[model samples]
Target: MLSAAATPAQLSAQAASGEAGLERSERAAEEQQADNIIVTGRAQKLYRVETTASTKLPTEPLLSSQNVSVITSELIQDQGARDAQDIYRNISGVSFFSYAGVTARGFRQEEIFFDGLRGDPYAGFSVPQLFNLDRVEFLKGPSGMLYGPGAPGGLFNYVTKKPQDKPFSADVRGIVGNADRIGGSAEVNSSLGGGFAARGGLFYEDRGLFRFNAASRTLIADGGVSWSPGPVTVILQATRYDQELDASRLRGVPTDDDGNFLADRRWNHNEPGDFLNLRSDVLQARIEAEPLPGLTLDATMRYNDATEVQNYHEPRGLFDSDGDGIRDATIREFRDQRRDEESWSFGGNAVYAFDLGGDVGNRVLAGFDHFNGEEIFAGRSLRGRNRVVAGLPSPLSLLDPVYGQSDPATYNQGPFSIFNTDSRRTGFYLLNELTVGPVIITGGIRQDNFHDDSDGIVFEDEATTYRGGIVYRVTDEISLFGHYATSFEPQDPSVQNPLAGGPFAPTAGDIFEGGIKTALMGGRIQSSLSAYQIRRRNILQVDPRGDVGNDGVDDFVAFGEVTSKGIEFDLAADITPDWVLTVAYAHNDTKITGDNGGGGILNRVGDRFANAPKHQLGIWTRYQIPDIGIAAAFGGDYVSEQVSLSGQPVRPFMIFDTSLIYEVGPIRAMLRVDNLFDKTYAVSGFIDRTGHFPGEPRSIFLEVGYAF
Candidate 1:
């Protein structure tokens, strides 16, 4: 049953989980600095993040009045995190919809940015390689006041590794893990002459999945050059990534009538020849100048090109046509799809600081950004060739399994039809921060114009959003803050209301949040508690009164509303010289408050949103024995039950992970095990009962690295 509030036990369970991980990381960073040991660039610290450039201006987390989580390179290496999904365990109220799509606060986050610039949609869908990244930042809540149009769930930003102006240094790492995982990466950083420096990295991996006939091979190369001439500095960065997957993990396993998963945990239903390939290229240039004292100007431009090709035989689930107790046959569907996207963006910002006499200061920031994107998609569904592998009286028998019998080439027939789309957006914003004694006030406003054209239909929309916040320092160690923000997201041009004969209007969202942040024990411990409520209007819903066209197009109306409210608690502490702990918990309750006479987009009013768990908890603790050069870490994650869009209940699950680390001189070794208990669960799923995504089984990975 759905509830409006979380139970005391649910809240406490999540709170305990969140604090352990936060404290461990904070303590580790402090100890490393105290011992004068440099690790991964510049000693990744979690107790205090003093500045974040992603928020349009460098701002401290405590003063910003928004919840932000920073996953540093040190943490990534410690946990052996390879992708975005792997890092989400340390953040609260965040989960994966699939390998690509992420959901926060009950809404899907479709927009992603790289180094403060808009990212290509297609490229964002692929699994990102973290070898060349310095850090990953998550800004929770609506962010349209700073960025452009986006989902209200917030966004993710990937910060690239920058060139170093220091002595030449290099690192090489090799990885071997279960499921046939083998990979290696190399990075080099050096300083040229005349204040110039360069950094380059190469990464390659070939891995097999727990399921049969599913594997991936990937290669990535990244390089960047930075030069500082007098007061002006310039940086140029580029990256190329290519990947091939034997089959997509999107096609999940089937479930029986009683919502029980039918296939084995390691079962894969795709044909042997099914595969997906992706190629992406990105180039970015940034320039920063201080033309006058107390003033700074910066400009950035980025270009991205990506293509994806996929051909797969997807499983459709089992059917008992004759109403017998056992399954009759297995249904399968085939698809041949290709997508290409090219995008470019240009943005600039100027900031000036001045004193307001008598211990007061002010800073003003102004920025403008413009982006253009074009995409082409071609897909063909082999419906006429749908196959039902009959004669297998009971395919669910555990004794023996049959697979790879169907020839996918017979269903590969396709006469591809191309669909083209173009999108353009331009936005400008102004922000100001005023500090007086122990109080800081911040405000910002933005205006955006968005245009989209798809299949010869054009839609243009404009939005104006604003945000305001206040941060008051109650003491040197504690700060209290409150914020309000508004956002708007335009609808896709292809999504139309048959009754209105046009695209629906953009959705609008508003949020109010308040929080308290504290740093204790001489900055060895940091903790925060925040509560927020968000309301989104103009959501689309099916119209029951409207007639359905012969083409199977159903009418829709923009008269639905959704509400998401939650409280999050996070703590990080260095309990002692050798012990560190971190923990985080989030309790989110999301439901559709209003809908048309018919149900909402995927459910009826008052129904909890799909894939949005009410309780989420994580804890990670690490201990080091300096004399013996050994370190160990243990972590666990918990997720409450979630409801599917179709109102099916997904069970709650908890999993544990551990790592052992050993280091001597320039050599380091780590052994990590994920899912130590080998619990079988589903992380996500589709609306229908046909598919359920199963969690990965227990796996072990060992990594070795040498730094010089």
Candidate 2:
């Protein structure tokens, strides 16, 4: 065992001393060649040395002016992260609004990208499968200069695994867990000879829920081929994903007036026959060329088609029929919905690098992108309906419940509602970076033209955004940086205001950020500390004189503003050869700063945003026993209390996770446990006082894999 009192500098010096001695011994040998023997080592640090997601250029994290988090494949495997939310625990100020929605820096984020291309907003419901992904990158703060027309909070980019030039390799894995969950995956990669390479992967899972009668099954398959005949390289990729769930998975357990949970955590009020199914198919092609020594050009195109079908019978809320305070009955509703969506995007960029005098270098990139998408939805709902059992009671008893007795077909369907929306956007951007002495200056600007048409109502808007940043290197291992950026997101087409006499304009946001980054212990430790403030304008506000409960064309006005400010600290270190640690923390404050007289109940000027927590912390550590080929890790997450839109309190909670792994030759085994304490808490909730989504209970998973 190593001494716990050893400082990072001391450990680094010791490692250096050992390496020096080994080199000396090799030099003194007369009969043996010193270069013939090589030593290979491994570390547990999760920090990535370089990333391109932030600047669209290969740059070191310490030299970038933005706060970025990179979750590598090793960390994902070690933690057994099943979805994006699972990996977000290590990133501060990022939380879940619902299974399909996420909140970052106090603002709701509905945009997700794949390989820098935009994806459908509802894609979150499918929960991306990570089996064929290389890594997940989070670029925080305003990103409009690169992505164009997105939430100011941040964006998540999923990097797909590409074909590699290597000998034939294959791996197969199987997993079994609690709640009757079972899963398996297989991956294969190889070179096809004659400058051609190919890779393929398949994943399948049948997951059970803690709530009664709730379950999901998913299947995902992806394949890619790359050809490198000359200086130019071309790649083609395709993927198919499908998911089916027993219900909508939105129902939550109700709480009493005192903000205390009243029902059992495992109780589910959704009908057994309720179902939701989703299917998506994607195709992509990319080409890269280096026609000149310092000039490179790349182009990419992607097309995606998806469909969603749902039939649900959901519990509205508990009601007091006799005017008493005690709730005696549960009200339910039914919905039958179907949607079809299709999207396509094509983009390319040209980068040129040049040198200016001594110690000065510069690079510039110019790109243009266009995207088009459409969604057609049809649905009908029946509200205020009684339970399926007739003559027994109008509503089911809240205290004593009997499930699987409801018949969805017996409910009278209401008037059918249908809508079709089509959207198109085109953007052109330019980015430039200059390095002089120890300083780096970066600047970018983008112009976007957006158009949306819904039910014969058309809206058109355009915006120009910009970003500027500077990074000053104090030493080879430390840097200080600051940045200013602007962003915009278009309002929903359905939102309109009588005062404006037209559709609402897009919301605009601006941010100012500063940070310090360091790479210590000979690149064994990486850390960053940052602070930022963001403000958004032109938010929609409810009209005071309009019919509050009626769905009128002019019930909302665009005259509101919000502010979010926060501080974040992150660190990843390989303290020693056998010990690794990662830590992150964030403190955030968000409030409505300006609201017109038409503000709604939750839009008070001083109220905090819903589902935005004030504090978040996470810590993870791992120790390896090389002799036994075993490693163990422990981690925990903490989130402060949050409130609903109506200011209803949701209590805070903390959960712990642990994992153990054993590896030998070509075989590996792992055991993981989540929510070890079995804490009961609410993950999210609705503002209608219906119920809160309950967190998962303690669960265990065992996985085994083999590589050949």
TM per candidate: 0.91, 0.91
lDDT of each: 0.74, 0.74
TM-score, candidate 1, is 0.91
* lDDT over C-alpha atoms for residue 197 of model 1: 97
Estimate the lDDT of model 1. Answer: 0.74
lDDT of 2 by residue, 294-399 (tens): 8989888989999988887666667775678877567776678888889998888888999999999998989988899988999987665444444221254556
Q: How many clashes in each candidate?
A: 22, 0
Kindly list the per-residue Cα lDDT of model 1 for residues 505-615, writing each as its tens digit: 789988999988766554556777889999888977666766455445667677878899999888776676667777888899888877776775543324777778889
- Residue pairs in collision within model 2: none
Alpha-carbon runs more than 4 Å astray in model 2: 1-46, 121-124, 321-324, 386-398, 497-500, 545-555, 601-606
